[model samples]
Target: MALAPRHLISLSDLDDGVLDEVLELSARLKRRTGRGELAGKTIGMLFFRGSLRTRASLETAVLQLGGSVVNLTAMSDFWELEEREGSVMDGRAPEHIKDAAAVLSRYVHALAIRPAPLGNSWDVDRRDERIRAWAKYATVPVMNMESSLWHPLQALADVLTLKERLGDPRGKELAITWVHSPTPASPSAVHSLLHAALRFGMRVRLAHPAGFELDGGVLSEAEDLARASGGTLRRELSLEEAVRGARVVYARSWQSLETYGNPTLTASQRSRHIGWRIDEKLLASGQDAYLMHAMPVRRNVEVTDEVLDGPRSLLYEQAANRLPTQMALLVNLLR
Candidate 1:
């Protein structure tokens, strides 16, 4: 009998050995050593939100691997999706995710979805109901393009970037610091990056304002993974203190979890940390640390131009690695 299809819902779904294999394969593919691994396969992507890197990279990766892609943007290509398990069909969203996932599974070898938080409470959004619903109903392999709680693909590219730059990341210190942003941002990248760094045995320092704490469950799980992988995890209220002597400094912004569901309250809390923006002086605090950020960053808000354009910045390389890492992931999932 054939085995059930594998899914890439979160970094935690991949064990150390499989994670290592994907990264190694990513490097090999980047070196022009692999092609056509995804030949004759089709991937169906449904987006509930907009994307630049995720959309471009995945589409390019599939085409480069000799596979075809079918893209669908919610509310444009189709009706708004109802994510709740059993809701009256009397609302704005016409179709249910169960029906959508099942229908797409018949047309593609794998299904991928990008669903952002619905501006609801963290308690509600953290469950990642939309993607979970799709995964539950889709017979084909499911991939998380991004979700409320995690961006596993971004985490994979980040780890691959670290491996390429640092050789072995086992003992290095990585600081994931929260920078200021006027608008609220999801904590998915932060959560996944923390998980990836910890899994690779890197000492991870998470720095953010008091109200900006990441999900407690994610933190607890990361701590456990760190202990198992010979890594150490710590939290800091001061960005400078967190980046001090670190080998890498990753700057990004996240919504105030304390004010999670309220945009006004979240904005008010974020305003208090405007000084948290990353600059050259802050970057100097690290051990000549390479700067990194998942893109679409607000210039002079989250980070200064000097640091982003600096020679030590790994931002572009991190973004570029997305293609090969995702290609490797698709190959592993489909072929």
Candidate 2:
């Protein structure tokens, strides 16, 4: 048997071989969810942020494993702790992250946390960094629900959906569209999804409006990975042009990095680019294009109801895979 990952933070943290193992294990566990393979285990969930998929997925995965989950939400009292200065004991909140980590470790077999980034733009990458830093002191293995920088678990489920429909993604045209949003949330899903696809040699197109472009160095990094893996990367301003005949279209709203942590500017800046919204017209360009999103999609904004509920939408699968992928991650780390 292969070794398991003690904690999952970012896809970039795992090599291709390890990632493949996770995908395979997740598929198996998904098929045998009620088999009691991991009975009597417990998972502790701490969210300094809000989540729908992450929370539900982890809860379900642990239960399927015959384990239990404990959930913690960021509270006003916790925010007060952030204000305290000096010694760990002096924080405004009653508990420090280090203390919280150790305490949670005592009762749970593994730890899962979702910390929202500080800036107005949701920097999923940065969230990964913060959570990992806390994990350094945690005795138990850590699982990332969604960090500012990457959503590895989410990506795992996403690719699983792709593999189900289109076998291997290498050389397949996939579009990661930057849909219009009222705010910029760092676009972690876009960054990580593309990062994963590129690593496996898939041709990827990133479509977004001007000034709404992704991090400058990200493409170059993905390009380097693609050059070695037989995939291609393209960036465009036209949604229809990018989606034309594409095999998969992953849509999500993200805050502009240019706007960074400024919420005031995010809305105004993104509105000018509202033309990027995904609708039936965009899908017309690619009749066979498969539609995807990480969920919590804003209706009439990032996607239309027709398209979201359409024949091509693989969103439920994307959402459902969260449990098995996370279980694979948890099992790898804790087992």
Q: For model 1, what is the alpha-carbon lDDT of residue 18?
A: 88
TM-score of each: 0.97, 0.90
Model 2 accuracy (lDDT, Cα): 0.77
lDDT of 1 by residue, 1-335 (tens): 76777888899888888888899889889989456887888999888899999999999999999999999997789878887777888989878888888888899999989986777788989998888888888999999998999999999999999988888999899999998887656899889999999888999898999888999999999989899989999886489898899989988888877888887877777778789988989889899899999877998888888888889889999999999999999888886
User: lDDT, candidate 2, residue 184?
Assistant: 43
Please give, for residues 42-152, the per-residue lDDT of candidate 2 as tens digits: 888877777887888778888877788777787832442232224556535666566666777788888887776766443444444568766776787787777776677
Predicted structure with the largest lDDT when compared to the true one: 1
**Candidate 2, 133: how far from true, in Å?**
2.0
Worst 10 residues of 1 by lDDT: 31-40
Instruction: lDDT for model 1, please.
Output: 0.89
